[model samples]
Target: MSTGIPNVSPNLNLETKDLKTAPGVSLNENQSTVLRSILDLFAGKPSLPKLALWRDDATFTDPITVAQGRDRYAAQWYGLQQAFSEIERLHHEVTDAGNPILMDLKTRYVIKGINKEQTINSVVAVHLDSEGKVQKVEDKWDGKLPEGSIQNVSSLLDFARPMWWINYYIAWAFWIWSFAWETKKKMTADITAQAFRHLNAVTVPKLVSVPKNEEEDAKKGN
Candidate 1:
């Protein structure tokens, strides 16, 4: 059975046959066949090692920072992997959306995670080298709360529960607001229907009511 675990560079062995084809405006049949073979080898393979080789030590190229060293690339790769794992979890959820994910349109990843009404959104930027290896991966985090909700309480809450009173309060507050908004909408619709019914019931004669008093005699002076 193929283990779902990502094949890290330490275990994967790259062969010359695994090299990617040269991208261009056009390629002859010979090139196409060679490229196909190369693609078949590299397409599904992990390229973590290639990414480790290209990272700049001083720059925070990814969401997490890594120190400069012989092993710095490995450290950076691990950081990126962590971020990617987080994103994977998010994409598993279906309720959240609108995540931006790409420098080139060719590669894209979107993530959305929902716990009750709370949602976590993340956009990941990824780059691939000519060898079809992962060159870079970056991540940004976003928290989306229900309407009229504050961040204080929501931020304190754990994955499943919050020890803070404010978290509970906010949860209840959102629930009430959501309920009230729906109730108000329904009430408005009902009231409008009732008003329409009353208007429909009024006849032409009823609408033309006789004047009660005022100038009763002056108006008839003719």
Candidate 2:
């Protein structure tokens, strides 16, 4: 079946670090297997399939918009395969912060149909269901253009051109708003935690019982 997506060359190089399961992140045997399979797929293992890692209702979100369903998510990868001639995983790190696992990766790839190669640094926050399938993947990447005098918008525009400028601006606005909101929430939580720590440290001594000698002295005076 032709997906209307361009086929990439098979000689893509993907260098990744050893996958480490995060501590304190509770994952069953099935979940662990799923996560390992996903890492292996991205690590350029030809035997591992990518589509099997995601659930039927999986959702993928990037800077542009959110794509729902496993097919839509798979389409996103198809787009990547079409766009990049050579993809390399510059760095990869996985951290488990309790529930969901966080994967941070830096990638550099040569854009197909364009003469210049580009680099993208991205962080993917993955959520898994009980059965170990990927339920949601939230990806945030630095989409800044590469540093060079040569500008090639024609090739990209030929592929996927924006219908309207309004949609582009709206996507940027939503991204900025979401980033600010998350930053504000994190700061507020940190401030609240600091206040509680300070209050406990200062007030805890007063709540403690008086010293034994002082109490006895006061009792004698009474």
Candidate 3:
């Protein structure tokens, strides 16, 4: 039965011959094989054999992740298969003159259960060691890497949330207690003043003076 969906892996070739490379520089046989594997990975075809091209300690960096070890790096490529139903390699230009081989990739991605397709352009840089094993890879989408310390500041602020919350609770408790104390003090003073005025108006008490000896004794006791 034709499902009306196209198969993804038809031709993943690196020997395109017309690719723009550095002047007087051509990719070797091993590099071509590795580049083909990379294309396969980008086409959402992740295999154990293709992942074997990377060293054990190889690192990979992309916009969302900075992964260490070949196995860790391969996980992202594997996840790509689960995300998109099909991936079509639209265009690629390779440069192999330097330590870091670069690929400018344009791809069409078809997400599962979605009617629309997305076109994405990316730059992949792979650094190969003497044994032709990948040492590091950096993938930048739309050829842009995130720059600035704002992200670092954001992480710090997130970590400091607990501390901020504790301080806020302490200050709030003090503010409420202080208001309670103030209200109590004002109520007591006002009530005492009103009671004294009402009692004085009701009764005319005899004026009595304390003896000088008793007053001196009270002052000495105080």
Candidate 4:
């Protein structure tokens, strides 16, 4: 059952601001649970500020310092909490129905004050692990504004924010995404076909050891 992957403890000193540390990023049960709690807390309310680690240097270390445990976790949690401040709901759907490579389309509602809403769309490529956990998560976004959407919602906001092509980045992003996708599809199809041809040559034959008698078969069954 072992994957033969060495258990190299991750550097705990990563800036904690620019990334999300999903719980169970490591295989260790205790570490995984604690990481999950931190992720859950930030995802749930995001307002809770102080984060703490229950272990000391004997339990956790990256090389340089010893006092960087709970504080590091707290910093990362805060960053994640801030990153999603503008979003309300994130929706995802699969594109390739038969494949695990999901076409995640996300529609985020931009928060307008306390209750108002604006729409921003995004796409992502997601890959899951054998355990049904997210093995990889890649975010895609267009910095451009939606076509005509900005014009439609123009009256809602103050006149200070001018119409820049920067608003058009979202639309441009979608265009770029389509192009990239088509190229990937062609390249992947070609690579897969080539790989399939090697399957027969590279596969090892199975060696089945048959039971010698009914008693042995019964023992094996047991």
List candidate 1 segments past 4 Å from native: 1-60, 66-70, 76-88, 92-120, 143-222
TM-score of 1: 0.24
Q: How would the candidate models be sorted by TM-score, starting from the highest?
A: 3, 2, 4, 1
Q: Write the per-residue lDDT of candidate 1 for residues 105-153, one digit (tens) a residue.
A: 1122221122123222433343334433334434333321112211222
lDDT of 1: 0.28
Off by over 4 Å in 2: 1-17, 20-32, 40-49, 142-222
Q: Write the per-residue lDDT of candidate 3 for residues 72-181, one digit (tens) a residue.
A: 56655655654567788888888554779888888887655443466767898989887777798887767854443222222443576577445644433332232233
Q: What are the lDDT figures for the candidates, one per model?
A: 0.28, 0.46, 0.55, 0.29
Best by lDDT: 3
Question: For residues 57-150, could you state the per-residue lDDT of candidate 4 as single tens digits?
Answer: 1111111111123333233223323223454435433343222342334344322223334343444343334443333323344321111111
Residue-level lDDT tens digits of model 2 in 1-222? 111112322222222223554555555444444455455444333221344557779876654334566544554443444334676777766666334667776766565544345555766677877655678876666522112122323344345535523354443333233333332334244444333322222222222222234344244331
lDDT for 30 in candidate 3 is 64
TM-score of each: 0.24, 0.49, 0.55, 0.25
After TM-score superposition, the amount by which residue 112's alpha carbon in candidate 2 deviates from its true location, in angstroms, is 0.3
Output the better candidate (3/4) by TM-score.
3
Model 2 TM-score (2 dp): 0.49
